[model samples]
Target chain A: MIWRLAFATMLVLAAADKRSGYQDASPETRAMQDDDASNPGFLWVQQGETLWAERTGNAGRSCADCHASIRGVAARYPVFDARLGRPITLAQRIQQCRVERQGAGPLAPDSDALLGLTAYVGLQSRGMPIQVSIDGPARPFYEAGKALFETRQGQFNLSCAQCHDGLAGQRLAGSVIPQGHPNGYPEYRLEWQGMGSLERRIRNCMIGVRAEPFAADSPELADLELYLGWRANGLDVETPAVRP
Target chain B: MMRRRFLVLTGSGLIVPLAPMHPARATPVQVAALIAELVGDATLRDERVKLDLPVMVENGNSVGMTVSVDAALGDVRSIDVFAEGNPLPHVLRVRFGPRAGAPRIATRIRLATSQTVTAVAKLADGSCWRDRVDLLVTLAACID
Candidate 1:
């Protein structure tokens, strides 16, 4: 009888935990939903689609003038740049395009242009599963990415694992926390009036963890983005996703 | 002796400031109702619906929120989320395929004000589950 009672108690606790957003799988279901079909994100996607084709900011070069199509480009992002020999996120790719290709001034990370371009590029790989390289030169970055995932620092003193890996598929207040997947970004968070870059989202979480948010294009953030893309290796791309 | 005197002085000093206190007020129920309407027939049972929010949101603009359901895959079909105080209460509706693995999701959201958030879960066997959570927002994060 005592053993049965103890077992029941444990089950209740487990259920309670699962009901909280303490599990790694908490974000999975939300990532797949299509709630905001009429949201401004769609509008941004349309605008971004235009920007991807239009030549602007003095170089007479639109994103389309050089790159053939966004299809293969999106899926192969966060790649190791031999010049930097480090990973570069999709946002960084746009920055590279603007500075090196278009001779346009670099837009701030959260600027509408960056958000739109990221969303537009991300849409091109809509159904492709994420594929970050984890071998050869990408190995060191993968390790750095993994290490960042497990480290605990900041005011809350809680690590990413505390919520994502250690307590995945669990709840915190009353919502089910999904897995840490970048599949649904550059998402259209209702919280943000329009589309947001995946890097901005990461910065948002860092604030939640009480860590000092990195600058938009900082190497630390790039490393973290690399890890996120690799962590969600097999999930389908759902850029411009809608969230509550 | 000095430390002892300071301790005694502190003890006495602390007692003089006793004042009436009020319990933290609970969030209104309309927010919960809004969530219910958004989720449809999914019932609000504690067993299946899981809702997560910070006890105190730093700002209402982009509070992190998550919702999930616990049901036998065969018995659970879909889950929906609603933020009563958000500009759009119908946050998300997640359907599970046999291949989707588990029923779970998470995302950051905007809350227009301090309000109760709810999640409703629908089971394939014609049953429903629900849960509601109260979020205290010291600084509203969503609207800005």
Candidate 2:
């Protein structure tokens, strides 16, 4: 159960040079992200705002009842939980509270309800730096994530690192390869024509490479998220980020 | 309606010979017929009006569009926008009053696929000016 492999030594990203996917998007896209009225992601944020006040389930409570505010909470996501004994993403944390504290049935992953709350909470951390912990119990998961990111897979046999790391700025066809940062998640991907979680984005890449995607609720996703959060340490969270 | 005079101008011989049964998915023939309907007997000129939209669109869901006509083209009457390939060919129409300032309209439209979007500007003098833009949707790299 002990992970003996150490990946920190091999990977040396110049955190200073870490550029957000926002910097690589088109001008029109940047404008869309900048304009709150035009940003479709705000739709989810608005939905979350409503859900925050509406009481649900046996507890007859709203998210507002316990957590008065969501500000700065998203910046510390994919956190190591003592009870769960594993790292959980911001989205999962929301569901955990809904099911346990609010007594609401678990919302389906990638559903509007879940995405709405995630986008809402993530918005509070807009411009705040990502700061996921990789120490102690979170370390094993982080290392696992690092291994997955660097491993070759799928019909194309491409690794996430081979593109996002080795060729971050290079053109893959027309699009400049993004460093694959998760800073802007529950993002409004023009391709999807709606909001999507980090899991959808990662699975999409796997599918793009003709590789099998992990399950929507896979622990591997959380592990990957932990690693990505650690990698994007100082990058600002642009939740509900407009992406082409 | 005054728009029906176009049917008379084209004569019964070229009145499409078919009704728009498929209200969705505007065909090239339907687009031409609709343009004719808007044009009436007036000739559709190809100058002094502009329809601006991105050539290579990232997605078809919400493509930004702008339509403008030259102020020198006389008192503006109306500017009608159309997409040759959308479910509804008549995307939007902006009617201008005598006091309306600039003859321009900027908004977004969804493209069902690659096609030409045209903007027809009608002056109060009955002269019609028009512009068109062809666009391609880039969509996504991975998902099919």
The candidate maximizing lDDT is 2
Q: Output the number of the TM-score-best candidate.
A: 2
Angstrom error at residue B82, model 2: 2.9
- lDDT by residue (B91-126, candidate 1, tens digit) is 778887777667777776766667777777878766
The sequence of per-residue lDDT tens digits that candidate 2 reaches over residues A93-199 is 99999999999999899899899999999999999998888999999999999889888788667678766776667665446678889999999987677899999
Worst 10 residues of 1 chain A by lDDT: A17-26
Per-residue CA lDDT of model 1 for A1-244, tens digit only, reads 3553454345334523322111222142243344445445667778778888988766879998887877846766688888878888888878887888888888776777777888888888987867777678887887887777667766655556555654445444333335466776777654454567767666766665557877868887777778777766665776766654
Residue B101, model 1: Cα distance from true site in angstroms: 42
What TM value does model 1 have?
A: 0.58
How many pairs of residues collide in each model?
A: 52, 0
- At residue A108, candidate 1 shows an lDDT of 79
Q: What is the lDDT of residue B69 in candidate 2?
A: 89
Interface RMSD of each: 12.6, 14.4
